[model samples]
Target: MIWDAVIQPFADFGFMRRALLGCVAISLGATPVGVFLMLRRMSLTGDAMAHAILPGAAVGYLVAGLSLGAMTIGGMIAGMAVALLSGFVTRATALREDASLAAFYLISLALGVLIVSTRGSNVDLMHVLFGTVLALDDAALILLCSLASLSVVTLALLFRPLVLECADPQLLRSVSGLSAVTHFVFLALVVISLVGSFQALGTLMAVGIMILPAAAARFWATGIGGLLIAAVAVAILASLSGLLLSYHYSLPSGPAIILVAGLAYGVSLVFGPAGGLVARALPRRHLEA
Candidate 1:
């Protein structure tokens, strides 16, 4: 009976199966990126970049009228621009990267909203904001698979440099001239992950899949390897639970998925084995003893 209730929707509907596959693919690609973001102390930067991609996507929607190819290209362009520009501004001027990123993302968001309003209706705007996960096509599936492959491969190649850069930027610079390349490549991966995930989770909520799972994992794991593994596992579990909840209760799939991630995050906060409230509190209790 439990199996039937939990497994019936996906078994009966092709859309449910596709949604699960898409979410799983996104989690695989995005969760590891999220780990690096967390380790780098740039979680909000990921959120800002997600917004920065909106203008390009909105412009694409305006020009191509819902063509996936156009929107994906536009979003990638805008996301990369914001990332590079923010990094450039920080290096070139006295301003901090976070401040510059905030300014750019705000402008980009306003531009996207204005463009979307001028060309499309509220329904169209909602689609851009919330996504159409249940309506994914073959093209979207192929794009998701391609992005997952690209992220996994690139991250593998850049792992050493990226870790060194994160752990000691000055040391990495002294030993290798590829620090800048590593930074840019990492930013590029962030852009790719965001743009690739936009179709399933939308620009607004896409970072949830990336950052939330990673945050939850941080409470449970000590090393980078463990953190990455835990994050991907948590994300896949959340995706499955969220999809099932959405199917049985008629909830919005994207938010449902995020909510599941959020729930996992909540549990981790209280009960995780590493840095959780319970774990931290235990140390205090021992000290008092």
Candidate 2:
């Protein structure tokens, strides 16, 4: 009976199957990037970059009226531009990366809302902001899977440089020319992951899937490999649970998935073994004298 409750919806419904597949693809690609973002102390940067994608996607909606290719391309362009500009401002001016990114994303958010409000109904705006995971078409699913595959391969190739850059950026710069290249490539991966997922999770919530599971994983593991595995595991679990909840309760699917991830984060914060509240509060076994 329990298995039927968990498994029947997907078996009976094609849309449920597609939504689950898309969410899985996003978790595979985005969670690892989120782990790196956390390691680099740039977790908020992922949120800012997610907002930066909105204006471009809105413009694409204006021009093409929800064409997947146009919106995806536009989001990629906007996200990359904001990332590069923020880096340039940090290097060229006195402003820090966070401040510059915040400014640009705020502006981008306002512009996006304005554009969408003028051309589309409130429902359309809601769709853009919150996404319709249950309604994913074949094209969107293909894009999600393809981007996930690309992200995995590229992250594997860049792993060493990324770790070096996170640990000792100056040493990485001194030792090899890969420092800047790796940084930019990693940003590209972020953009790709965000853009591909926006079709399902929307701009406002896409970064949640990226950041929350990774944050939860931090409390469970110390090493990069462990973090990656843990984060992906949490994300996949959240996706499945959230989809089932949405199916049974008529909840919004995107937010349901994100909320499940958030719940995992909360659980890890309190109960995880590494640095969770319970672990810290518990008396440590006295080290053998």
Candidate 3:
């Protein structure tokens, strides 16, 4: 019964297997970035960057139809451009990083939608906005797995400096010249993860897989390492559940996966032990005299 309900779907369908693999890769790569974004209080920044990729992707689609390489490259270029430009604006002007990012992303989003609508059909627009996980080809799968591997390794190298930066940016800048480098590199990782995942999750919903699990994990764990682990676990579980739901009910895979992750976040908000509603609501024990 369990096999038919849970395991057989992947076993029987190649597309299901591919979709699972793609989601797992996103969970591994993007969730860690999401964790760091949350720690840095830049959660909305992820959403902005996600939107920033859309115009580039739309341009790629306009030029090359649906060529994965073109779209992925365009997305990376666009995301990096926005990140760099935002950083520049923040440093050069009185504007904050978040504000700069918001401006760029909104512009990018509108421009992207306009480009796509001008050139492509509503179906193409839907694909760019929502993704086609079950239709992942070999090239897309390779791209997702390769990017995930690179993200994991890069995060491992950046772990110490990143933690320090998050906890005490002043201290890190004082001690190490790598502060700026680490910041840009982390942004690059974010861009790469989003570009790679946009193929499977689309521009609009890709950040959901990245951010929601990390948010949910916040309520479950205190340590950075624990948070990373818990977030990845939550993401993977949501992916599985979402894929199954989509298969059985004909739901849109991207939104379905995000909805499942959102559900997990809601549950953790209420029941998680770290600082969840239940924990906060419980009465404290009296201290001994």
Which candidate's lDDT is highest? 3
Candidate 2, residues 81-153, lDDT tens digits: the string is 8888877888789998889989988888888889989988898888888898999999999988999999999
lDDT of each: 0.92, 0.92, 0.93
Candidates' TM-scores? Answer: 0.97, 0.98, 0.97
Model 1 C-alpha RMSD to native: 1.9
In terms of TM-score, how similar is model 1 to the real structure?
0.97
lDDT (10s digit) by residue, model 1, range 132-183: 8898899998998899889999999999999999999999999989999999
Tens-digit per-residue lDDT, 132-207, candidate 3? 9999999999999999999999999999999999999999999989888889999999999899889999888889
Better of 2 and 3 by lDDT: 3
Q: Score residue 51 of candidate 3 by CA lDDT.
A: 91
